[model samples]
Target: MAGDGTVEWGEDRPVRLMDRLFGDAGGGGQRLSAPAAGAAVVALALFIAAELVPWMSVTQQQQGIGPDLPSQTSDVSLDTVGWGITAAYYLGLMMLLAVVGLVQVTRPHTRRALTAAGFGLSAAMLVLLVGAIRRAGEGGQYGPFDQGIEATVGPAPYLAIAGVLLVVAALVISGWRPVMATGHRRPAPADPDEDDDDEEPGPIDLTVTPA
Candidate 1:
């Protein structure tokens, strides 16, 4: 009960919720670079472009009797399925991080960041693996080692290694920056006085005493 026009309140519900969520945020906080995001977007665009446009060609050889042989050139077909999957993966990753950044959401915990990266890479790799299986099933000219290398080189093994490398590269690129340490231990700001003390040198005694 208050006689005055202004009434005293105990606490605001929304304020409490916000404080819990953002931990009494004091400043604008760490942010993702818009330029970096743009770069990612451009790279994704290039990948899509390469997939859509006829950018590469392959050569085929034919054998004929009497040494009459000609080299045949053909435009490389799009790995439509594989390229689409890769495009989606890149776009999805950019969108995921962009939304988080735009919303001012803090970077996820390190473990979660790594896990997301791993999972995304695995999903992409799974798509490629499926495609390779289909190619094998279709009985293409691909030899026993049809994944990438010839029969002399193991295709399946190379593809697996490639997938692993992709995951590692993505993980490194996305999560290399330092963050709040594992224990949330923030670095203490340097004390101004301590800095001055370091900058100034102590006096040297003129008389030297031998020990």
Candidate 2:
């Protein structure tokens, strides 16, 4: 029994704790709206496409001062995989986060921690992508003759930027909350009719009525 004259069940403590940490435990917390979830799905799809397509293009040209000298040009393209392990690892992590977010979107409750994590990771990925573009724009040179080399940003990087923006929009629309499962159940309301019926009858008229 509680000081308020109410009985406290063994499960009440944990329920209250969960409610305090993650909003209403009875599934009343804000969730990812349908339209927002759709946008997130599209964003994830764009990110995947970005990984598969070329992100950068490199062109190398060689020329000699002599009129008889022959000139040569070569072109190379690099995708997410071509960036090496660091880029690959980041892509994998982002994909995993996307999957988790999708699962949460399907549920009724939301977890604040997961939502915050998704936002942080997505933002980090965007930063890395932008940095890669900036470095590529500077270009590079090779050989003693200083052979000219030009690096150009590909469509894939731009696509990734779009995806990241969409992800931000989705998170904002959903209020930065991810769905989570909880064991809390609201107590059922009492029935007044049942309470009245449970009362004992006053006095059974035992006066041997008229014979």
Top candidate (TM-score): 2
Q: Tell me the lDDT of model 1 at 119.
A: 58
The models' CA-based lDDT, in order, is 0.42, 0.58
**Candidate 1 Cα lDDT to native:** 0.42
lDDT (Cα, tens digit) per residue for candidate 1, span 1-211: 2233544644444434323333423344543333333434454444445345432233445655656577665443324223653455456545544432333233657545645655565565556545544543332243334333221211332334343444434444543332321223334776776544223345666997899
How high a TM-score does candidate 1 get?
Answer: 0.33
* Clashing pairs for predicted structure model 1, backbone only: none
List candidate 2 stretches off by more than 4 Å: 1-32, 63-96, 99-103, 106-110, 140-146, 175-211
Worst lDDT run of 10 residues, candidate 2, spans 138-147
What stretches of model 1 exceed 4 Å from their correct place?
Answer: 1-26, 33-66, 79-106, 109-114, 117-120, 126-168, 172-211
